[model samples]
Structures are given as C-alpha cells and as structure tokens.
Target: MTIAEDRAVELQEQIRLPRSMRLRLTRNGLTLVPITQAHWTTQRRIASQIEERLPGWTAVGEFSVIPPREGYSPEPDVSAVPSDQVLPDASKFQEDLLRFVVEVVSPESEERDYSTKSDHYALRGIEAYLVVNVLTARWTLLTRPQGGTYRHAVTGDFGEKIEIPVEDQTLVLDSSQFMRV
Candidate 1:
C-alpha cells in the first residue's frame, strides 16, 4: 500500500472514536473541519470536552449514526457511543449502541440538525440528542424517545447546567467554559 493508504489504515486502528474530536481521515490527510468553518473549533471543543468529562463514554464527531433497522441514513454531527458495546467494524455502528448525539447548529446546518436529524435519532431510539447553536450560545436537549419522536425537549442558554437523562442515569453537561455567547 502507498504511504497515505497505510497511514489511513493505521489511524483507523488508533482512533477509538468519541475521543477523536472532529477529525476524520481521508486519502489526502486528516480532516478537522467538515461542517462549518466558523464553528468547527467550537464544535470540536464541545465534543472533546464531553469526552474528557465522561471518560467512560465514547464521544465521536461527524459519524454516520443509523438505526439498527435497514435503510437508515447514518450522518450525524456527534454521537456518544457507549464504551461497553461491541461493534464489528468502524464503518457503521448500531443505533442501540449510541447513548446520545450532539449536533451543533450552524447557519449552513440548522434545518437538518434541528428537524431532520432529530426525527431520525428519535425514530431509531437514540436516548439523548443535544443541539448547540454556538452563534447564539444556546443549547437544546432532547430525550424520552417515543412514538418516532422525542417527547421531552428542554432549551437553555450558555453557562446553564443541563441534565441529560439517558438509559437509567443522567448526564450533566456544563457549557460555561466553551459555549461563549
């Protein structure tokens, strides 16, 4: 294999997901930005912070998140994959294995993150979904997935502590540090 291809293979093995931030490997090199240029750093910071705080969980950015059922789209901003779950490969991960998803709303990605992805995650039984709008520095947490949608939706500004209930426990997110208004 060529050097670049060999490096991709090596990176694929070393990257353990959720902890890698917004980085993705392509044939060219590592990609740290794919969604919005303005908010990529902020997005990466938020995902990395979550991974650091919740060391036991897998917090990955820009991964394809799909339902266990067939024919589900797998494009999400950030996904919190439970570390205890096992997957066959990196190409795809079952929705049931994902405990939460975080999508930062940029001007270019507001509609998709707010409406489309929310519907998909809820339909697939994802326990929690967080929508962060860095420009406004606001956060919305969606939980209690039922009837093909999240029954509970809570919104708060930056610096506020948001409690995200997932599985049988609660994950508290403190956005005071990174989410600047």
Candidate 2:
C-alpha cells in the first residue's frame, strides 16, 4: 500500500466508529451517504414536524448525537460522537455514534440508506435507523439489530405515523404527509 493509504488507515483505527456508519478511506476523500435534493426536502419536513411537537426535546437539523469516546456527524443523514472527550475535536465518526439516523430515501440513495447503512448501524448498537422512502411514500423504521442486522422493521405508509424512542425516551415521527408520495 502507498504511504498515504497506510497513514489514512492508521487514522481510521485511532478514531472511534459509531454504529450507523463506517470511516472509510476512499479516492473521493470520504463518503458517508448518498444525499440528494429530494432527501433534503423530506428531511427538512421531518425536522419541521418535530419542531412543532415533542416537548423538552430538541429537534436539530444535521446536529451531533455524540456516541462513546468521540463525536462525528455523517453527511446529511446523522451525527453522533462520544462526549467524554468533548465535541468536534473528537472528530471522525462512523455509524455507531447516532441514537438515530434518518434518511429520506431517494432512488439514488435508497439502496445505500436502506441496506448498507442499516446493517452497519445495527452492528454498532445504534438504537434506531429510519428510512423515509420518497419513492414509495413509506417510512421504514428498523430496530432491534442482532447479529449485525435489524430483525424488526415496520413500514408506515404516507399519512401513517410511527413512534420512535431516543435515549430511552419515546417520540412520535409523523408520516402524515409522507404517505402522499
């Protein structure tokens, strides 16, 4: 391997990985998720919906979710880093840091968000991972990952709602408008 490749690999090893994603060294610099305009639009809607409801709870837009020993935010989907060492500086996070990660599935990103990320997140013990599929107009909620995969997942169609738990707290994710997809 090239010296640069070896150095990057070493850096990944030194960093902590969250449950939902992985820190990969690629020619593209780094890749977290496949993000798109449709995904962003739906994500904004979901965020707005949360802001309108949920008491004592903060609905952050692309904010951090601090995992175990470090903190890192995935592209457009989620962020989680451990707080013991504090924020940002603990940089470089993968899937496990997140309590939850939401993906508004676009055709371009659907496969990655649903299968690839789902498997990675489960292995790291991320509590919940949501896929709001714009194409199908359905929201897929996956939980209870065992043996590195989510064994339980419920697909709530548009207009249907799903209740999710975070940090041992339950919060409702409304899919009322999403059902129209």
Candidate 3:
C-alpha cells in the first residue's frame, strides 16, 4: 500500500471509540462539553452574566472545565446527532479528540488550553472550539477551516447574544441577562 493509504488505514483503527467511555455526538461526527462542579460555578456565573446583559437568549448549556492535553476533542456541550448514523470511533482521533473538552482558564491551566489545546484541535479539524476566556469575562467562538488552522474567528462579551442557526430554529445565547451591566 502507498504511504498515504497505509496512514489512512492506520488512522481508522486508532479512531474507534472506547467501550469505557460514554459519549454523545452531533449528527456531523461528535460533540461534547462536560459540565463539572467548577464549570458549574463559572458556567452559572457566565449564564447569569449573559442573561443580565442580553434579554432574548437562553442559557441552555454551560460547563465547568478541566484541563485538556493535545489531540483531544472534548464532547460537545450537546450534540444534535441523528440516530441513523453511527458515531465514528474516537480512538482514531483520541490523539485528537476530547468528549466535550472544557478547560478551566485558571492560571494553572492557561498554557494547556489556550496555546496547547487550541493548537491540538486545529490539527484535528474539530468542529468546534470555544475559549471561555474567563479572564476578560468573555467567550470566544472559533469555527470554519482557516488556512488549515483554527484561527480566532470571533469574540463575544458576556452581555452579547450569540445566535446559532440550527435547522429552521435559532439558538440564541440568551447570555445577556448574565452580564453585570
């Protein structure tokens, strides 16, 4: 087999999802964003912040974060996956996957999530990468394929509303109420 074909075959084997793991995915492939205790605190804070600042959005999902290493794609907060399609095994991308990976932006985890983790997601073509920039009390949304790297696509403050287009329905951030203003 040629080098590329050999690699693709090898990659397929490694991408299988683990039996021990419990995962949820969007129809596209996968999506997870775990909400932990700390994430709860921060997420609550963020949610309230958004609700107070904006009036129309809904604080639907919020996550407490944990540190994530390179090549990991955390589960999306919620994946709108269809029942018919099977989820691609994560083993192939474990080196590049996290089941809803959320990183606490504490000083301790700064390097891992912002620089290291971000770089890792870009390499794997992860569908979503959200940097809950806790410091500035803001959230950043990064998406789309840009020069093969996940560049800083957009930034929103705690008060702003983020409208995510899903089917005919609209998913608004509803974070305006969370803002202190």
Candidate 4:
C-alpha cells in the first residue's frame, strides 16, 4: 500500500470518531467532517423520499461503504441497497450491494462531495450518485459509470425533480421541500 493508503487503514482502525463526525479516505488521505444539523436534515429528507418511492429498498444514513478500490472507504450521507441482500455482520456495506449513494455537501466538504467522492463512487460502478449542495440549493445526479467516471450527469437547482432509474424502476425525488443550509 502507498503511504496514504496505509495511513487511511491506520486511521480507520485507530480513530474513534464521534457520532457527529464521519471519516473518509480521499486522495489527500484520511479526512473528517462534522455532520451539521442541516446536513442531517437534508440527508434524512432525501432518504425518506427514496424509501417512499422505492419500496423494499433499504435507505440508510451514515453507513460505511467499502468500494472495490483498496484503502477507500466512504460513508455516504445516505445509501440505498437491496433490502433482501443479506449483508455480512459488519459495519461496512460492500459496494456491489449499493444501488445508490447520496452525499449532502457541507461548507467544508464541497470539493470532496463534488469531485473526490463522485470519482470514487463511479469507479466502484455505483448505479447512481446524487450530490445535494445545501450551500447553493442545487443538486447533481450522476449515472452511467464508465472508465472510472460518470458517463451522464444532470444538474439543477433545488425544487426541481430528479428521476433516478434503479432496479428497472425510476425513483422520482421531489426536491421541492429539501432542506437547505
């Protein structure tokens, strides 16, 4: 492993993060960001919408997701996985089981949400990745992962509708009431 990867593993194994914070392995190494109230609210709102639209799919918040890439573990603000796919008895969810991942952009995590996490999720072949920016009240939906990047992207301001195709069905998320910081 490279120095950054080794450090990421060490940090993951050793660090005791508080409930209000989450750690991520980025290109720069291990990084921590505090979860603000607005962030939590936005996450919950999105998750609720997903659950309402996609029955039988489990939408969880702040769960660890282990991508195929080594030394990269990201806890998306919200993740949707198959409810029937029995997961291992561990804290991390394998990327193969993840149908969708959502990241709410905080002031300190704008770049990571828009770039770093997007690249990582695409590389892992996640079907859909949504980025909600509370600062600007805008959202971006990325899909069609190819060659370690998203082949299609759609961006719009909050209050616009985002239609995400998952498991042969389309999840229509109404961002009209999504919380903004």
Candidate number of the best lDDT: 4
lDDT per residue as tens, model 4, 1-181: 5776776677777889898987766667666878888788888888888778898787776567775375667778887777886455556788888877898998888988888888889888898999998889999999999887999999999999999888888889898877887
Each prediction's total of clashing residue pairs, residues at least 3 apart in sequence or on different chains, is 4, 18, 54, 0
63 in model 2: Cα distance from truth in Å?
A: 6.7
Model 3 Cα lDDT, one tens digit per residue, 59-178 = 333221223332232332322222232234422123222222333354344455566556555655554466665555566666653544665467778677655433344445544433
Model 1: per-residue Cα lDDT over 1-181, one tens digit each: 5565556657865865453334544334554433454366666776676677665676665555543233334456666667666354675676777878787776645676788678888888888888888778888999888977999999998898877765666667777754442
lDDT of candidate model 3 versus the reference: 0.43
Model 3 / residue 143 / CA error / Å? 1.1
Cα deviation at 132, candidate 2, in Å, is 0.7
lDDT of 2 by residue, 20-95 (tens): 4445444444445444555666777777665555454434445333342112223435332334423434343444
RMSD (CA, Å), each prediction:
7.7, 7.4, 10.9, 2.2
Show model 2 residue runs off by greater than 4 Å.
1-37, 61-97, 179-181
Estimate candidate 4's alpha-carbon lDDT, on a 0 to 1 scale.
0.83
Better of 2 and 3 by lDDT: 2
lDDT ranking, best first: 4, 1, 2, 3
Error of 1 at 80 (Å): 1.8
On lDDT, who's better, 1 or 2? 1
Off by over 4 Å in 1: 1-34, 67-72, 86-89, 179-181
